[model samples]
Target: MTAVQRLRSAAVLSPPLLWTVVFMFVPYSILLVYSFWKTQYPIFVPAFQLGNYMELVRDPQYLRVLLRTLKIAGLVSFFALVLAYPYAYFLVFKVKRPSVRLTLYMAVVAPLWVSYLLRAYTWKTILGTQGVLNSFLVSTGILSEPSSIFLYNQAAMVLTLTYVFIPFMVMPIYAALEKIPPSLKEASADLGENRLATFLKVTLPLSMTGIVAGFTMTFCLAFGDFIAPFLVGGPDGVMIANVIASQFGAALNWPLGSALAVVMLVIVLGIISASDRFERLGAGRLT
Candidate 1:
């Protein structure tokens, strides 16, 4: 309201506001321009036509790949949530030793510090024909030969992504689970509610926020990932991001790539918006 107060408020907000405009808004504008341009002959014309988007809609290959990416991301998010929920519940309610529990959580999240590329390549060695698992199986007389089932496939891609993103899922769920008051569980028990009933009515409802956050984070990462698919997905694991990369690389169609990116962006933003709406509704209902 006063000059001094206004100046102080402006000083506080300026850095983050400037950073968002410069780093986020500016880059998106450039990408938006590229998405509308045409790449034909030896020239990139500013045609302002929706031909690039039209091709993506009409072309079955692009549609299929887009659907495949969505499916894989959905599965990755689902599996990550399922795996994380129990571990988070254990940490929240079961673990009594604070030091041990903290150490265990740290160990699970330690892989986040490692290089993503290195993580992807680690799977390569483990899944190779004469890799560790194969060699062990052969030595144990469980298999006569090194099986080709482990490497360069959809299974490998999904598994690798899930492993890499598991921490993201766990951390959010843990944060959510931590918020649930212990007294709520005790109160439920005092009401003669069974463990299962109390959990369903109290713990799970309170932790729904974490599930939504984890799913959103995991799905976004898995959906946009190109490197994981490239290293592990031989043929079947190729997602929309891989197709988008090909357009810029061997496909040599920057316009098409930009178009695909725009489509992906739209879908992701739509998901976020939908999630936000659901979150608000859920919160309102809880209140």
Candidate 2:
């Protein structure tokens, strides 16, 4: 390339590159260093050690919390997928009017306009012992008094997370489904394949890219979520993020917290890599 062309290209890329370095790389680099340090009473000692990571594996409480976090993340992803796929499919395919489809799509994602804390607290209010659901049930003669079944549990955590992230699952899947060529479906029909068969063979496989993206995103967000648990998830819903927060908060163990944060970051990166691999394979097969 010519000097002028190269300079223009560099100018276009430099802002984003600098933004990433300053906002993303630098913070993560600091966290990486902090993770290796040791914590003495009242302070973190600058030294290389694997003690924090070791404790994560060695301690049963941390292990349990990690496993529970995984379980909740998985559940939230699954439920979000179940709810999102049909809605997205309807928006992309079933809905006939363009205006109507656009409106409906906006409705699904409109909750995002509201504050996340408000959304979480909305669920808490609905699920709490004397909250909306309980009041309705009691008033309807379904129950003698307000019940506590809906809040303060792992199930509540999963439900809250699923509701919050369903829009994340929907948007990508809607875009993927919209991108699908009608000729592919027409060709499948011409070959005497039924709608269900064609979808199973052609549509679903083609949409795997979006599915993987949404699943990976929802899982990662749900896995790291601490606020929803604080608002709606009680004792049983404590996840790895909560544990990590405790270390940084009242526990005052920065090294251990940093180590936990690093581990979570690594896991998320691993998931993203796997999702990319799957997307490449799916694309290659479709091609």
Name the best candidate (by lDDT).
2
lDDT of 2 by residue, 129-242 (tens): 999999999999999988898999888888889999899999889988998999999999999999999888888988988899999999999999999889888878788899
TM-score of 1: 0.95
Model 1 Cα lDDT, one tens digit per residue, 1-287: 99999999999999999999999898888778888888886747777988898999898999999899999999889889888889988987789999978987997799999999999899989988989879989999999998999999888888899989999999988998888888988998998999999878888778777788788889999999999888988878789988988888886778889899988999999888877777666651231
For candidate 1, give the lDDT of residue 284: 16
Candidate 1: segments with Cα more than 4 A from true spot:
284-287
Q: Estimate each model's TM-score.
A: 0.95, 0.96
User: Model 2: how far is 229 from its true place, Å?
Assistant: 0.9
The alpha-carbon deviation from the true structure for residue 92 of candidate 1, after best TM-score superposition, in angstroms, is 1.7
Model 1 worst lDDT window (10 residues): 278-287
